[model samples]
Target: MDLVLLAIVVGIGVGIVVGALGAGGGILAVPVLVFLLGMPVHSATASSLVIVLITALASLPHHARRKNVDWRNGLVFAGVSVVGAVVGSRLSALVPSQLLLTLFGVMLVAVAVAMLRRALRTRAEERAEAEQALAEDSAAHDPAAHDPAGQEDAEPVATHDDPVLDQPGPDMVDGADGIRHHHGEPEVPLSPAAPAAPRLPLVIGAATLTGFLTGFFGVGGGFIVVPMLVIALGLAMRRASGTSLLVMVVATAASLLARVGTEVQVDWVTTLIFAAGSAVGGMLGGPLSAKARPSTLTLAFSALLGGVAAVTLVQTLLG
Candidate 1:
């Protein structure tokens, strides 16, 4: 196959993956450019940076429209990571390429393990929640269940004179946020609590590490960002993915700027073609991501990470 065509195909696949999961997709571009298109690693890295930035920007709109992008948090994370990106860029030359690739492989494996464990924990939590809800529902309905007043907590009987009373009088309904609501009582709107004070430090630390990886590898650190947002920030998977892309756009752009006037070489024509394909794929993937089940997405993302890690490990060891 023609090299340009091959690159475009690879780019499309990477873009789709990125759009869906928010990270690790663009990392494949470097290997494809280096191994398949036969570009040197440095050139491939530079070109991949361009593609990563373009692809992230392309898919961002879809996420924005869906209200999945957390702009405040994303910007904060990106802003902090920029400092780390600059530092990582400066240190990139000091590291050997083989060692860098090996480290990248290790990082991918670690992320995969973390994702798998999270998925299992989430599943167990959901199961426990379901059982608890069922028990509550049963107790609410059963006449044998007594309240603290020692009277059976039976459903209230409606009087013909008060037609509204015939309808199920307000009993306690379990809410998703672990709050229970009494039907007859005025519902207290439990407003969203202020952002947790403790999360700022966690965000800063994660973003700094992510920025370092982004600059050192010439790849977006979505893999790191997505999980951090989900695990630490309490964002759902789709929101985390969207926010990760937003951060990637910032970090990758900064990294690319750092390379300006450097000795890096790029094949602009191939890069453009690949980027075009990525843009198209990204558009398609965003909607699909929002529709996907979180557990399924997490498992699939973990598998992909594991696959990439294995490939990188073998290549690094063999070469």
Candidate 2:
């Protein structure tokens, strides 16, 4: 029952939770370190950052080794996110812990529901695409599937523009700033449209903000960030997972810096134990996550969020 051994245990437990469930464990780390181990909030916060940082760093290499991460996309998102995280880290000093926890719970639940819906829609679309491909395959295999009408020459339609109505693009139609005026399309198409420029800066800004929340409120923010990437940014599941780990690393790093030179009583042993469990789980989690149906991942994520909220609430109430 040595002190460092105790810290390692806590660390490994937190790691296991993050790897298995992907969030909320980080938040628990601060409180446990402070209460059970008698570390002040400041010291506990810093130490928790160390734990999160190590866990994220360890987990990230696996994603890279598996070639699961899109480096360009992750780096772009991380760049913008650093600024937001710095701002958030500063703000963390001002916000009360109770309020932060409450907000975190609300956000977690909301994001979970949104992701679940998206997973369902993705599944339906995938199924439809599969059926279409099968039908096409059968048609191509059959001798009579092709019709004479399919060989008909189709004429291109002429473009018409209204000088008063449409905005210009490409051509100087009607002298409207040399822009083409293609008619009959939504002014700004929303999500589900064809992939446009990747919003690398915006994604990074979001991650930074999320990082600040992590430092301030002790939230990992992976739950929120992961869904946002999938739904808002249109990133795939593995991509979201990889990007989240990267952002987590930055947030933890900041927290560590924020707590340096403080007399923090870190239960190194506990932390180490938690990190060990998480390391193994992290490796297993990624491939399992990839094979999971989107809907299942979404649903499971929501359930975990709820479970974490319940645990926090109970602890808060009992305390």
Candidate 3:
């Protein structure tokens, strides 16, 4: 009974991470099951898949309600990733348990370092934007700063050659229904000029890699998917996070199905209890994440991953 309670508590924590960040469910779950619940590595990895699948599915509705999901793109990415997931699951059976744990530790460290670098970059960008805003404000006050040529009385010339000015205004967006909508307004038919297409090849390559990682490590692959959606598909961080959940649901399901015939045994009782707790946590985290700053959350999560990785490495190598 006590162990079941502990599992619930741990699952909630893992689910909160997955729900809020759109990743980390399996990364955290595998270690917790092995070290805390005394489950074997193989069993833990398989069980982690269940926890991730449940959490992602539970959290997805909240993001969808906020219009954060891009259904068409997410489905395409998931479909391509299924092949990679099957291949990776087959390869995972060949690797030894100790080696897999060690590799998982190394991957955690790499992800932590990458996240730290991204946080630092975001901070620098924010600082640069603030400085630029200050400079613009100062120039507005001192007309001479912006009008060095001293042509204040001359009529300003409108230049159509500057493509930046021709772009859609901030509030305009192409909705899923093939209409353009102004912020908080009714949708209208889109203009004949359409947005540029996303990079299909890059997206496919990233999805395949994400699937391989999910199957091999029992991770949700949201860390990779979120970044791919943001950089390759031109989604904002919040939208990318929501969209990544949709991808994770498919990726985890594919990986789990591939393991069906394997000899590895899963403790269904513990797995279901953990999943139940995660489902509740997912409900809370989705709303909380929508209110929090992405940079702050990313830095905190990276630190947590670093600590977990250190502990896992020490225990695996020395004990």
Estimate the Cα RMSD of every predicted model relative to the unseen true structure: 8.7, 9.8, 6.1
Per-residue lDDT over 1-319 for candidate 2, one digit per residue giving the tens place of the 0 to 100 score: 5666666565555565565434545665666665566655544555566666767776777666755455665555555556655565566556565655456556555665665675577667556656766887898787775676764763322232211112222112222332222323222222244445445565655666676667665556676666556544655455566667776776666655554443444556555654565565555565565466555665665665566556555554465
The CA root-mean-square deviation of candidate 2, after full C-alpha superposition on the true structure, stands at: 9.8
Q: Highest lDDT: which candidate? A: 3
How do the residues 1-319 of candidate 1 rate in per-residue lDDT, one tens digit apiece? 4887887787888888878877765577777776677776677777888888999999999988876788987898899999888777767656767777787678778888987886676566556656766887888788766555655553432112111111111122335644333333322223355233437778889999888878878889997898777656756566678899999999988877777766777889888888888877888788778576666777787887788778878987896
Better of 1 and 3 by TM-score: 3
Q: Which stretches of candidate 2 lie over 4 Å from their true place?
A: 1-47, 93-100, 130-143, 146-196, 228-234, 261-266
Write out the backbone clash pairs for model 1. Answer: 158-166, 170-183
- Tens-digit lDDT string for candidate 3 (38-76): 988888888988889999999999999987788888888
Q: What is the TM-score of each candidate against the true structure?
A: 0.79, 0.66, 0.84
Q: Which residue runs does candidate 3 get wrong by more than 4 Å?
A: 134-195
Which rank order by TM-score, best down to worst? 3, 1, 2
- How many Å off is the CA of 236 in candidate 3? 0.7
Cα misplacement distance, residue 216 of candidate 1 (Å)? 0.4
Error of 2 at 241 (Å): 1.9
Whole-model Cα lDDT of every candidate shown, in order: 0.74, 0.56, 0.81
